[model samples]
Target: MNVRFEKLYEETKAAVMRYVSAHCYSITDIDDLFQDTYLAVYKSMQSLTEPIQSSEAYVIGVAKKVLARHYSAVRRLRAQIDVSLDRRSGRGLAEETADSVDVEKLAGDRELLDEIFELVTVMPVTVQRAFYMHYVLEMSFAEVGNELDLSEAAVRQRVARALTEIRRLYKRREQL
Candidate 1:
């Protein structure tokens, strides 16, 4: 360590530590942030062009940058985690619409289930297979395509067409 940096550290370490401690919530985070602050200060000290007039303020500025970076990274990671969870939970547009209907409430109605099956059975064989593979078996479009030797787009088209037809049939039955 440079003699100048050692002197600067001795002078401003306490203030930097207090700043980091007050901003950070966890002890581990505090320790990490404190280390990062000092490491940044050390690097800045190495590239000295002019003598820093106020070591305390300079150290505090470094700590603030470290804190900002830490918070930004945490926010980015949380957003990525939320996106992963939504994908895993099957919360895409079609799935969200399906979820709006209370399937559990209708589960005991055998006649309704039969009518749904009849509507599904009316779909073309490929459409029926696509719908079953994608929704019933929880397979992705790519997986369904691989299994049936169809393109993913073709599989998606089949499933979407089936859903639209089924929704129409369901509404007609409800009108009756």
Candidate 2:
């Protein structure tokens, strides 16, 4: 191990472990996150150009990225499962249309998609991510949970809130 990295690990390991533990959903995830955090931090430290005020904070930021990437992969896996199940069940586009508004029309309208994009941009970041994951990425609420590290219910609520806001905005715009 590099001397500086060894020193950093000695200084920050306990606090980092606490953070990873608090954020992790599983014991396996805890180990993976911790190791990935240090590896990222080590690479970052090697290439660092400017000074960071806190080593622990920087390492924690890298940990956050690792967690995000991990969750992204999980979401992809969930989406794949969702797709396979849909295929096996013979659920087609019309079936999906019955559950929600047909995004197909909006998807075909570049102008409408652009307008909705702008509307979503102003919403809270959490809602935006959930909305994008569920609608744009074509993930179910359960898969959206993987992206946000939230419960399926929680991601559903976020997307619902975004939809409510978009409906309100569209109604108001129509009266103009």
Query: Which residue pairs in candidate 1 have backbone atoms (N, alpha carbon, C) closer than 3 angstroms, thus clashing?
Result: none
Per-residue lDDT of model 1, residues 1-176, tens digit only: 58888898899876676566445533235568878898999998888799899989999999999989876876547634222232223213232224245556567868767756655555555665666556655678997787667899998988886676555434443444
Candidate lDDT (C-alpha), each: 0.66, 0.64
Could you tell me every candidate's TM-score relative to the true structure? 0.42, 0.42
Put down candidate 2 lDDT per residue, 12-113, tens digits, no spaces: 886676566546544335678889999888888888778657878877888888878877976647634221232223212122222344445445666555
Return the lDDT, model 2, position 85.
35
lDDT of 1 at 63: 95
The TM-score obtained by model 1 is 0.42
Alpha-carbon lDDT of model 2: 0.64
